[model samples]
Target chain A: METTHAARAGRGMTALRRTSGIIAAVTLTTSLAACAGGAIGGGTEGGDDVFKVGLISPVTGPVVQEATAMQRGFELAIEKINAEGGVLGQPVEVVTVDDQADAAKSTQLAQRLISQDQVDYIFGTIPGDTTAAVAQVAESAKVPFSSAILGNAGVCGQYFFPFGEPNASLLNGLLPQMIADHGTKVALVGNDYAFPRGYFADARTVLEELGATVVLEEYSPMGTADWQPVISKIKAAAPDWVLTAVVGADATALVTQADQAGILDSMGFTGVSLIADFYPGLTDRMHGLTLVGRYSDQLDNEANKEFVDAFREAYDFSDPIPSVAANAYEGMLMIADAVEQAGSTEGADIAKALGEGEVENGVFGGGSFNEDRFFMTETARFEIREGGAYVPVETFPADIEGITPRCA
Target chain B: MDAVVTLALSVFTLFGFYALLAVGMGLIFGQLGVVNVAHGELVMVGAFVMFALADVPFLPRLLLAVLIGLVLGVVIERLVLSNLYERGFLATLLAMWGVSIVLREGANAIFGSTPASVRAPIQENIEILGVSYPLYRLIIAVVALAIVAAVLLVTYRTKLGLVVRATVDNRDMASVLGIPPRLVVTGTFAVGAMLAVLAGALQSPLLGVTPMVGAAFLAPAFFAVLLGRAGSLPGAIFGAFVVALLSTVLRTYLNETLAQVVLFALLIVLVAVRPNGIDWRKVQWKPRTQPAQVAA
Candidate 1:
């Protein structure tokens, strides 16, 4: 009789525990539902009065440096504008999406920013593929979009504004001087892709015009593990200068291997889109490397100093600002000035104002838009100093000839 | 002549790395009959482990990576794979794939996808046959070959090897013989995982450590598995060497895109001609009198 009574008590306890679990689940579900509803309703409040801007960047991939720099530039610009009473008497807001340099994901995120977040303007992106994807979405949605790093002509569209110096303009100004100083023979090593190929095509024209021969043109697939063969080939070719169209980890690997092979100690390493952000990690290997860029940490200009100071103060970002970030910073400030001059938040109006020359005091000074919607800005050349920082060697004036598109 | 010597050294160095990856992948497929989609993640785990222990010397860091990989393999086998063992091939494949996604996203979430680099302990250049080569690459090649030899000895010359071979041949028969198949499965997977981690740790300096670095090795490893005898260890190593040789030679002479095209075409021809890969001599094709049935 005592055993039976104990069994009955155990069953009752089990039933109580089951009931409590169900109750807890229901309470949690109810709370989540309420929170989601509140979030949706909150986004709808003020509607058109709130100017929402969406930023698409590769925040977690091999291009994190470029993404982080772009984020800082956007944040700094947004903060400054908000402090001075934002556009149209409403505060500006930003939504950042990490594309991770994937085109399909970029499309999904761009659509979400447009349909879900109801973002009015789209500001983006570091990679060529992601930039093209975002630009397509913005063009369809009639949202003002600006690209910060992509300089390819294929990505240019009606509603898209490219703020970086295009490959054509960059190569046109930088290569002649390189050929004159380095040698008449060049070896081109790049990843097998459209961006690198496009840069090579543009550079080839300039090289041929300057009477320099491309000794060898080799392309490796992305994520290639071994580069010794390519290094051996480069050494065999013995070009006066090695022009690398590689980026991210491949760029690092090529530079590292070349240095290890003592090729950097012998030849001039110069090219378009071979970023130097990863150079600091390879301080001992960067003695003979030079790259053409728009922003350098060792620039002697007051404008650059002020921008750098404000950037550090605002984002607490201590590293040398990538050239792409400076492009984004200037792009954001230019967008703000255009919106203020247009006196409206409409995409077309702001684009028109931007075209009509509303933003003059750019980060680098002298910023204007061409018929192709590409930003015509100054390009600078920098060589790696004794330590790791890049020091400015030369600066090119803004071009009126503008960017030549690779496509219709 | 110097260039030829350099090219030969490169092919040899890459062969060791590729062999490590292929052998581990083959062992799992042969014994477990489950294609471990999470194999690449195991490789990533190894790289991250080395990055975490960057201050330590290479051998100790590599040993730690092996231990961690073994623990992880055991845990995965017990908690997830053990239940799915009887659930058929599709179920196991999907489960392993889900695990792969979880691991990749987990690394991204925890480590923030920032590129972490490993400073090679041996940073000098060594001259080989009048050609200068990175000293670290040479070390990796030597260590990898040693590892391959050791694993071969362990698998072919031990009591444990006999049990593992029995389990691979027929799990039910092995179980009926009182040799627990579960223990064999767990042990084989642990060893495979250890090899993968070691390979990743050794190659981290050359590749530049990133969360997605393992994906680059995944396709080639799978190709090696397909080219070799599926259930044979020696065949897998031979297949790795062949694949590595083709890749190096073609990539040297032609562009990467064309090289991949030719490589895939070669794989198709091989599959059509010899379905058992290079291990047809070991396992004879026998006509089945009974229809295959699902395990209860």
Candidate 2:
């Protein structure tokens, strides 16, 4: 009788616990659904007078810092443009979407921006994978898609406009320079992902063409903690130069590992995404690290200074605004310029104006987009030093171009 | 030669961390028959505690980190795990999984989703076969080995060890025998959680502390537990070393994703071949002794 009563009591408690669990699960599911729904359907409706641009970024993921900066830059540019009588006398309003740095989420956000919000233009995404996903949506919908941070060649096609250095071009241009200046042998290290592998392959082809020997290519998973194995391989290879293409949290870890292992002093290290944004965390370890990009905070140009100053005054954060943010800001301004030139917010018309051979001076030392909708501009390389941020070491002329033959 | 030495050093260092994680899971599942899926979260908490202690100037940060891990382990066992005692496998599994999500998300909210890391205790590199390696990793390996040895001694030689063993065999019988099985179970859980904390605190300097970082450690730890047989300490440690070595070698030679898939497939195969685990026979089930016939 006692055992039966105990069993009944236990069953009763179990039932109560299960009931609580179901309620909690439902609440969580509903909250998440509502947040996603709000992102897709919560904008002021039928307001055709306002030119709405959708800005998508990883606002709450591993790359939130970069995403936040890009968002700020876009907002700042829109503010400035609106102050100057707006685009085509209609105030430009941006509808921001948080992709959370996930590729699938980026795709969904792109669709929402196009079909749901009816945005005039879409901009911003840092990682290559996220950009690639968004590019497809833009192309299918025949909407003008311009990216600020992701500059992989794979992202460039009919409907996409990349406002920064394409992966292949950056590698082709930088690798040969590295080989000519340093030596013929180099080691490559990067996060194991699509962007790094794609860019490294480009660098390998360029290095081989320049009679350089590829010593070793080591990859660590994204967010990997240990670098001993890879660093050990780098040491063994004894390459004259090392090239890296990791981003976000992994970027910091790799730099920290390299600094700890004394790889920076032993070999010349160059990377594509290692910039002022990633350098601050490295402290004294930032010295002698080489990287290539479109702009640095130290670029002595009026437009660059103005953008930096405005960002500093607005954000009030001590950290230097990342170049990714600056590029996004500039990209937004360029899109608004193209829209005004076309005198319409139609995607097709804006795309044509963007490629109409007009010399538009906006930011990052202005250059006109070529027939391919990518700028044939000077590439900037900087050497990071202690306390002093990424100081510009050299700049190649805009006319000097290198095209990567597509790999089969 | 340098490459070989470096690879070997990496394998050993990785083995140390993996072993610590595996042992923690082994203790919980072996002693309590409850799979604490939130084992990795306890590690994350330990890492954060180390991050907090990083600025203190006086005592060795490493020691302070271990102490923090111990406290966290005790707290988690007392507050969360004690209630789940005697709960069936499915219930405990679901509860722990939910706890993991809450802890990970809560960590993101508190830590702001940014990766934070503490500096390695020793920054100097040790040269082996003309290759330089971080001395901190070597220290981690030594410390991990020491803890393992101490745990083995305590479990094998102490009176508490006998009570724990009996409790694991039959909780109801042990409690009826005046063992206070609940206290024993909670104590073991706390110790297991502490082991996880130690592993994370030691590893935090090498790997930055991110909310989702626990997911990475969890997979390998589970693989180790499954491969070693559910409850064997020695089996778990051996499994951890083997898996770590295999993963490191495969990653070096094959594509990263392929390596992960291959390792998980291997674990599945091991489990299939030995459903009762590697040391199934060692798990003793107490015989049902007839209650003394009530006097007529």
Candidate 3:
């Protein structure tokens, strides 16, 4: 009788536990889906009088610093534009989505921004993958989308307007000057992705064209912590300049590991689009490090100064303004100009205007969309100082025009 | 010669970090028969703890992290894992998966998605055999090895070790013999968690401390555990060293993308060949008949 009772209790316990597990799993899945779904839904639905511009930023992932900077810049532009009687005689309303740098999440959020929020114009983000995802949504929706920092992969087409340095332009605009200053023998290190590989291909062509030799090239998977093996190879190669496109947290690890291994002492390090967000953390290690970007905080111009001053007044002025912020801020201005030129907030109309209009005097040293519908801006070089600050060293003319995309 | 030494040291350094992760994960799996997908999150929590205690010195912060891991482990085991212990592997895995998501998202929500970091206590480079390397990296490697040794000693020499071994070997028989299987499993899990947290705290200076940073370490650690003896601590440690050396060498010689492809292919071959991954169960460890007979 006792054995029977124990057996019955054991079976009952198993059933109970299984049921609880199922319930827990269901609850968690449902909750997560709800949380992710609900976030992109609650936008204050604006009437035709308001111009809603959806800004997709990776506010919660590996590149949060860059994303936050982009967010701040967008907000600053909104504040300034609103102060100046708004865009297209309507109050420019901004809807910010946290993409988290995850492509899947970015796609979901992009759809939400377009369908649920009814955003008129959309601004793409810093991380290449997220920007690409957002671009897909904008293309399908026929919305005017502009990316401040898309990778060289030409992920944007048709309705999208990309103004930043694509890999070809970035390499052409920056490498020649770097090869001239530092020696021609250059080593490339970057994340093993299409963007980095594409940039490296561009670098080799540009560097060799400039009468420089490509010494060593190394690529690591994203988020790799151990860089010793690569660093050893780099030391052996002893290249005149080491350029890295390794980004986000992986960049942090590589720099830290390289600094530790004393690889930084042997070579002059230069990177493409690296120094802005991570400047503070890398202050002590930035003795010989140089980077190229379209905008710098040290730009000595009235427009830059005004933008900087306004940024300081609005946010943590003590914090360094990353170049990405300038790019994003300029992107917003470009959108406003496009809207004004088009005389309508309609996606097709704005995209047309974007191609035709010129951002006469924005934060990114004033430029206009070219024949290829890419932003044409002068690139600048900066040397990082010991105290986590950068000094503008040189500026290149906006000669490197955007590439004609062949992506289907 | 210098290249060889640097490569060896690099592999060794990586192995130290992987050992902690693999052993901790192996311990949980050996005792409970469930892969704790939340193992990496425990490491992440440790990194966060170090970030929180930035004002505190590195050594004290690490000790505090271990304590936090212990408390956290106990709570997780008692509230969630204990009920799922007999509910089969799939149930436990799903539960742990849920736990991992909650911890990762909870961190994101609380920490506000910004990557946080702690300064390395030893900022200068140390010269070893005419090669300059980060002193902190050397220290982390040594500390991790010491932790592995400590865990090995506790597992092999103590009365609790015998109970754990018996429980792992035959849970029903061990339970019938008056060994509290739940307590043994919970205690082992806690110890494993504490070690993982310590590894994370020690390596915090070297890597970026983001909410999702743990995902980076998860694959290598899992590979180490997979290639090692499933229930053997020593096997796990040895396997981690092998994996680290292989990964370092491959990544050095080939491009990172190609290296990963090769590594996974190699792992698949190894899994097929070994089937049970170098069985350590065949080796007999004579347990003391009495608790008093166990070594100090």
Candidate 4:
């Protein structure tokens, strides 16, 4: 009886070992499958017949309108390209990410597009701060970054191409003319943020140079509503002209408040023209206000007229086309042209081709990049009338005399 | 020289506005155990309501804005706080936060994404101490001060104030004595909400009415209430002034982010040193009553 019991115990131990081995094999297989799934799902590969391009933009927050316009412009350019024949005989594909106009998010989004999405090129960032944040990452990764919105001088990376006039230069170029027309005494008001503050500082310097006296300089935090005290201060100071550098909703508030206070009629108001996107609604209050900008709604160019007509038809209304959108659309076409010229999708080859001084027909007339990969374009000025429509006044070419070497 | 004076006047104008918001927040939190996260939104509503009625002229708009505030106050008490009294602090906080989000997003949807402005009814400027100041800002400051004085009078001298004080002390005893705790609580909350709305309407001419503007005021108002102690109206006002002065000085001399950091640090220290609040001595602590022995 003892021998039989011991034999049964040995058989039980053998059965236990076989069960443990089977469980271990199953766990190992499951782990491997999870790892394989992660690799396949990662956004690193572009499909066989499409050349993927990544577009990062601020599709929400304060700058949503401009961002929306840029996206539309980019889509229009892509459609035109596909109609003729896509890049390198393959259809073009676009992957979009919204940065929400945040600087840190823009940087992360750019990195994801370069490393994960594995896009052939990246385009769009509106504000200067966001542009600067993404440019460094794109430079290090050797990915070509084309900015359609930001025009700050601080954003000059070896791998970056800025497609608009710098904000400081745009204001500075118009300073002498403004002083000559509006007189010497000036009041400066701006949004207490990076872009406005920077542009206002530049405006001050240029105004002082043109023999203008800055009577009052004030800043309000972004989204502030009450302007009574600020307006009262303006009335007391009684500056000959008011130079405003506010953007978005804040701009509307400033103009409306000024009109209500009857300050606009008395003071010659000039702003760093943010008239392209929401000019229609502001027409009544914005009348007689001068704005400095790049593209005017009244520009008589065939490309501009077609773009405006197409945009109006799509929206079923006369929507203002921001110059940023135009620049972004042009940037995409320039990238496509460079790729064709280089005959490859390699970053270094495309960068070299872009800098080869080849003039091409683009949304902005006669588009070409300087040695530093900055687009050369003329600036325009517009006057806002009582009806919220912009009337083109004059166009000024890129101030070749003040073209300084890339600082960074 | 002119620019320096103009800057100083602008800073003072901002300070006056801050003081009004702080005092209102302080009064509600000090007397009632409710922390009003939606105070800024209440102010926003008042501003919009005032703007809509601004065409009726100055005095009418001001009166209408106050009435709107009173209505909003009662509505908030009935719809939001009545259900929250039994659930404790976390529930009240979450409820207020959710309400704020709903109000802000709702305003955005209704008004669209654009900001709307109200013209200051008065557009004159006054020069004082070699600096040019807006007459409108002066008017706002005077009105705010007057409102503060009136609130103090109502709280200290009125019979209703005594009932409110009694309710704050012991709700059970007040209810048992026919004081009607529900009526007092609702009345106090409604009054607080109205004050916030009044402050918002007064600020419309300077800042413009936007859905998100309330968030900016909400933070500073909370800071004032906490620093001043939860139930002291005067303390709240003092706290607001202190915060405004600190912010103004730091913003003028240092970087913007640094100014924010300094204010936050000061708040942390204030809380650490006085955990109960600046006016904790006013609260009465009561001993628990023992249960009666059971008869055998």
Candidate 5:
């Protein structure tokens, strides 16, 4: 918004302030198209002969820990890929920037990456809204963009490749068994944000479709300290289990306060983005809870074992690695393969290759996109163990077909 | 009925912490004429102290946090803030703002950014009206309010209170009478910081302790301090009550988003109407002498 306002003021005529500034708008769009000529060409005219991509991560905000994990996984992937003959016969160059989980900052950073850094592709950020912001910028610049986070499958464009879990895969894999085992009555609670609201909206449909009743739906603002009133409401509703989408600090506060209030003991608690990143804050409280997501370090696979061992050794990490980190690892490998298959250092070629090729022995098992450019990674059910390990319990295959349209 | 009961309890719980925060802010704003913009970070310091000393018993941990707050408050005042007060309000405010960044980033570097927690000193569920409430919450609230009352008594009813008030009213005159205004300012700022730290320690068990958590406490406490008359400690407590009650009631009836919007709007309206702030004790009636003279 700050950039837009500045650009508008620079070109806008005072007489046309109240009306449409068509002249300024046209000039800006024309310049934008001209600036995107590098992407249109097969190469960036760089002398280095390196495949470069920019990462806009949120390193200092509510999702800082998750972002850090993703960065580590991303870096590790590049390190391993470069060590093994490199992508397109040259090491991948990654220019990283922090966007603080803010959409506007993300848009600015994405623009900077495309224009100033002259990168072939863009990656990252957490949550759906920031992805949308980066996607818009990536689309405008004609840069292939992707992230290793869950979102609605509908966020599609020609230059987008999502190598992470989507809402459909998450709910389809987890809810049926969850509802069958834990009665029909459910409570939907989360931080009142675009992602959680949309997530719970999808969860609500899945629950009802599985012959369940959503007893209560509550969303509190982010950074809420006193959750007693909300807890009181949830208790009064008396649902069989609580499906929460609260993340970051609020996630810890809600779960901790809920445990103190005896809600976790009385009713079951399970949600996406719940157990792993928050394990330190919610130690023994998360012991028995089970959740489903795309990636877990505990997966009984050879590639996963290598990735997990390498990730732990590199970071000296002991706690449960977040799904985002695992997805970042897979996403980077997929991009590297796409670059190799495209056989060019062009954004258009890379995006095309991403659409055409399957993940070649990446962690989370090799799979292709399920039609609408959404990765069809198999989901796994994991029980939270005492030592911050998401002990894998069940696997949901990547069998979902067709585009299940979620956008108009 | 349970909703009403819950709302009331929630407000009471919220008010305890807000009162602590606002009174501290009110003191700094009132006595030193400097806004301690880093006051919220002071709260984070208390929380991190609790997180770092998880092995210590809760009560001793809280006391250590308060002691740290006192020393931190004095050291900060002497090093960064003491000289800035004479430069201007903006200087002092900016200095405190810089202090806030240092404290926040310092905590982040030491503790890492993952959310941490402290065990509550007490844990049990007790019924209040018809609702089951945490005994720790109730005890903490009462303890906080009791601390506020003790401060109030010391400020209003003690001989030291008279000396402090005289210094604030006319520092030059008080200085002439052998009262060191510098010492008073430093002491008041330290006490204010200690109060905020105390609030944070008590509330740590309920919070997801992070370097960024302090930013959330600043706005409500800012409003609470603003809704009171300058230098009126009781008025600050009342402002805290109003902010807490209004927010809790709105949140009870509406969603969290709507509640925040309505509460912000209400605060804006209140601030616009009473810029000097609300003092119910100052309500007085005057006998009408004339129908009025519209001043042109």
Candidate 6:
């Protein structure tokens, strides 16, 4: 009788436990899904009168700093534009969402922004993958989309415009400068992704054009903590300089491990990985490193100086403000100008006006979008200082036009 | 010859970190039947601790991380996990998953999403066989191995080990034998958590201290634990060795993408072939819970 009673209790306990487990799982999943979907700024709707733009920034992912800067630049530009009688003589509204750099999440958010929120334009995404995802959604809906990060690959939609430095603008100027300073033998190491692969391919063409030999091309996956093996390979190749495209948290890890492994001391290091945003994390390790890029906080211009001051005051950010912020802020101005020229918030009308509009000397020394719909960013060189500053070394003319567009 | 030395040292350094992580996970899973998905978050906590206490000396900071890990482990187990253990596997898994998100979001809220780093206590390099290896990495490897060794000694050679193992093998039978299963389970989990915290503290200098950084260590460490016999600690160590060796060798040879594919394939094959675990003679593990029913 006692054995029968114990057996019955055990079965009852099992059934109760399984039921509770299922309930807990369901509750947690629902709560998380809810938390992930939220909008920034006010709940003010974008009616026909307001120039509403949907901003997708990965504010919590590996690219959080870059994403945060993008959002700040977008919001700040809107604030300034609204102060100046707004875009098309009305206040410009923005609905921002954090995608966390996930492609699917960005896709879902983009759909909601278009079909649900009824945003006129979609702006911002850090990595190429998420950019492509957002572009796909925005294109089907005939909405204008732009990204503010560097490097591009794959076939994009007609409505897509990249405000970041294109391959030719970034590498055509950077590789030659690096090779002239270092040597012909160079290695390309980046995190294994579309942008890096395409970035290196562009670098290869430029190197071949300059009669330079590519010693090694390595692409490690994201989240790679140990870079010793990659370092050993580069050391074996004995490249005079190593141009890396490693990005996000992986950038810091690669540089830290490479520095510890004594690779940075031997090779001339410069690439997208050595951005101004990474200065604080690198500290004194990156001192004396030189790289060429579009914007520098030290750029002596009235517009840029004002921007730097405004950005610092608004965000209380002390480090060298990244070029992406400049790109986004300037891109917003360009967008507003296009909207004004078109006299309409329709996506096609805005795209048409932007194709003929100039950037008003925004951050990348200002230029108009080419027939290819690529923003021809200007170039300048900066030396990373001991105190985490990008001191301008040499300024290059904004002569490097973009590569041939590959939009489908 | 130079390349070989570098590769060997790389494997050794990686192995040291993986061993610490896998062993902790093994102990917790084996004793409590809870697959603490928040194990990696605990590591993130340790890294953040180092980042937060930047002015504190490195060694003392590591000690403090260990203490904090112990306290946090006890609190989590007692408050959230203790009641849920009898509720079955899914409950504990979901609970731990919830804990992971909370810790990650909490860290993000506190530290902000900007990645930060601290200076390595030892910045110099020691050349070995014509290869320069970071002195800090070598020291960390040695220390990790020493701690893992101490864990093994206590686990295999101590009476506490016997009581813990017995309770794990059969909770009801051990209870009838006068063993306090709850205390043993809690203590095992605390020690397990502390080890992971130590690994993170030691690795912080080489890492970009971010909330998401711990996510990187989770997969390989998890593979190390699950690839082994479910309850066997030594098996977890062997599994860690395989992971470190395979990853180092594969990444050394093939491009990282292809190497990762091949590595995943091979691990899956190994696990599929030896679902009962690649048994090693003379090593004892607590029987898995379902299997313990047969013993009962």
TM-score, B chain alone, candidates in order = 0.90, 0.87, 0.90, 0.87, 0.94, 0.92
Q: For model 3, how does the per-residue alpha-carbon lDDT over A1-408 read when each residue is reduced to its tens digit?
A: 122322332343333224435657875676467437545422677877578888887766567767877788888888788889888786788777776667777778778888888999888666667677888888999987887764463564778787566666556656766777778788899988667777787777677778988878888877776677788888888888788888766777778777777767766776852566665445566665677767767777888899888887877555457766887888888788778878888888888888877766667666887666667777766777656556778777776433435343
Error (Å) of candidate 5 at residue A258 is: 0.8
Chain A vs native chain A, TM-score per candidate: 0.83, 0.86, 0.85, 0.83, 0.85, 0.89
Interface RMSD, in order shown: 15.7, 7.7, 8.0, 22.6, 12.6, 7.0
- Model 5: pairs clashing at backbone N, Cα or C within 3 Å: none
**Considering summed lDDT, which 10 consecutive residues are worst modelled in model 5 chain B?**
B85-94
Candidate 3: segments with Cα more than 4 A from true spot: A1-50, A60-63, A93-118, A125-141, A150-158, A167-177, A300-318, A401-408, B109-117, B123-135, B166-183, B280-296
Off by over 4 Å in 5: A1-45, A399-408, B282-296
| Interface RMSD of candidate number 2 | 7.7
Binned by DockQ into CAPRI classes (incorrect, acceptable, medium, high), candidate 2 is: incorrect
lDDT for each candidate structure: 0.73, 0.72, 0.74, 0.69, 0.79, 0.81
lDDT of 2 by residue, A1-408 (tens): 122322432343333224435546864675456448536322765365466888886776667767877788888898889989888887787778777777877888899889988888888877778888988999899888877764554656667887766665466557767777789989888877777887787777677778888898877677666566567667768899888887665666777788778877777777853666665445566676566766777788788888878888887755656766777778777778888888888888888888764434455676667765665556677777667467778886653234442322
User: Model 1, DockQ value?
Assistant: 0.16
- Model 4 segments more than 4 A misplaced: A1-45, A60-69, A72-91, A183-194, A197-242, A249-269, A273-285, A312-320, A333-345, A349-363, A400-408, B1-16, B48-81, B124-135, B179-187, B243-296
Q: Write the per-residue lDDT of candidate 1 for residues A31-111, one digit (tens) a residue.
A: 445323322112443466567788886666556767877777777788778888987787787777777677777777788
Across A325-397, the per-residue lDDT of candidate 5 in tens digits comes to 8888888888888888888878788888888888756678777865577787777888888788888788888
Who is ahead in lDDT, 3 or 6?
6
Candidate 5 lDDT (Cα, 0 to 1): 0.79
Question: What order do candidates take by DockQ, descending?
Answer: 6, 3, 5, 2, 1, 4
| Candidate 5 per-residue lDDT over residues B165-267, each given as its tens digit | 7776667788899999888878888999888888888899998999988888887887776687755778778999999999888887787889899998998
TM-score of each: 0.84, 0.85, 0.85, 0.76, 0.90, 0.91
Q: How close to the true structure is residue B75 of candidate 1, measured as C-alpha lDDT?
A: 84
Report the CAPRI category for model 3. acceptable
| Per-candidate alpha-carbon RMSD to the true structure | 9.8, 5.7, 6.5, 13.4, 8.4, 5.2
